[model samples]
Target: MTDARVPDRIAVRGLTAHAHHGVHGFERENGQTFSVDAVLELDTAPAAAGDDLTRTVDYAELAQRLHAVLTGDPVDLLETLCQRLADVCLADPLVEAAEITVHKPEADLGVPFDDVTVTIRRERAP
Candidate 1:
């Protein structure tokens, strides 16, 4: 058997949406910006060789779906949100793995910080 190797990546960055995702009541009441970055791992050979849009992931549709997730429901933790995003990325059958990142810039940590983010990676099960 051959070893599994990392696949080629298609990435979307700086996708931002306003949502109520936090433990604090105030946060839920007044939504804040949540930025996301998704990296999809897939074998692009077919798409490239055929020059077929259908052979590859439709990123426009993917972005819309990701936006829907960001605006859909309330979550208490970035980890949960990241998982959801990962699920969306892997929904496309072409994708072998996904890396998701959620950024909460306005988190109420009581200390000065540039930003807060959570990143997670998930792979399709064999």
Candidate 2:
């Protein structure tokens, strides 16, 4: 038989946010800038042919949903944030799989760095 495991992929990058996501009190209270990157796996053949937005994943809508997730809830860890984002991406009917990453610029560790990020991947139930 031919290969049946070919995977489709879509990417949304440079998603930025400001939120209070951390363990420390200051981190929760003061908040900080956060960024996100997401990759979604879905069938694009139909959309490619029809050239219709409705036929495929909408990045704008996805970004808005991600924004809502970030600003709507408060979490204690980046791991939780990443998982939540993955859940959001997987909620779409067209999405078979998703990889999500959340980044924080001003971490509590007092290190000089651009950001700290967490990533997670998930697939829909077959």
Candidate 3:
């Protein structure tokens, strides 16, 4: 629920991309700017101690992977996008949990807001 309760997260914030994710035909036809923030829960002790890139989860590659999933397809809902991103983050062996948020700044909503975002969190299966 809160960052203080989630100590195992490797926060990856400010990931931006272009996607055609919405319920309208125009939205699907014309992509919009989307921002993503992913917090991957993993034990970085090994990597921290060994000082090796391979010893722990690489945030750079993770960002690219999340970007691919976000822009790879046209989803009708932000919830679906968040779920998929969570799934991808949990796919890694070192990841124990993840929280993914997808924000649409230029959404077609008539409301006067900066953006609309969907956030989801999940843990790996035992």
Instruction: Give, for candidate 3, the lowest lDDT window spanning 10 residues.
Output: 1-10
What lDDT tens digits, residue by residue, belong to model 2 across residues 1-126?
997977778898878888888898888898888888999999988899999989888999999999988887789989999899999998899999998988887786666786788888899999
Compute the lDDT for candidate 2. Answer: 0.88
Candidate 1 residue spans exceeding 4 A from truth: 1-5
1-126, model 1: which lDDT tens digit per residue?
896776889998999999999999999999999999999999989999999989999889999999999998999999999999999988888999999999999998899998999999999989
Model 3 Cα lDDT, one tens digit per residue, 35-125: 9999888888788888987977788999899999988988899999999999989889999889898888898768788878888889899
Q: Candidate 1: deviation at residue 5, Å?
A: 4.5
Global lDDT of model 1? 0.93
Q: Which candidate is the best by TM-score?
A: 1
Q: Indicate the worst ten consecutive residues by lDDT in candidate 1.
A: 1-10
Clashes of each: 0, 0, 0
TM-score of each: 0.95, 0.92, 0.90
Q: What order do you get sorting by TM-score, best first?
A: 1, 2, 3
Better of 1 and 2 by TM-score: 1
Q: Which ranking of candidates, highest lDDT first?
A: 1, 2, 3
Q: List the residue pairs that clash in candidate 3.
A: none
Which scores better on lDDT, 1 or 3? 1
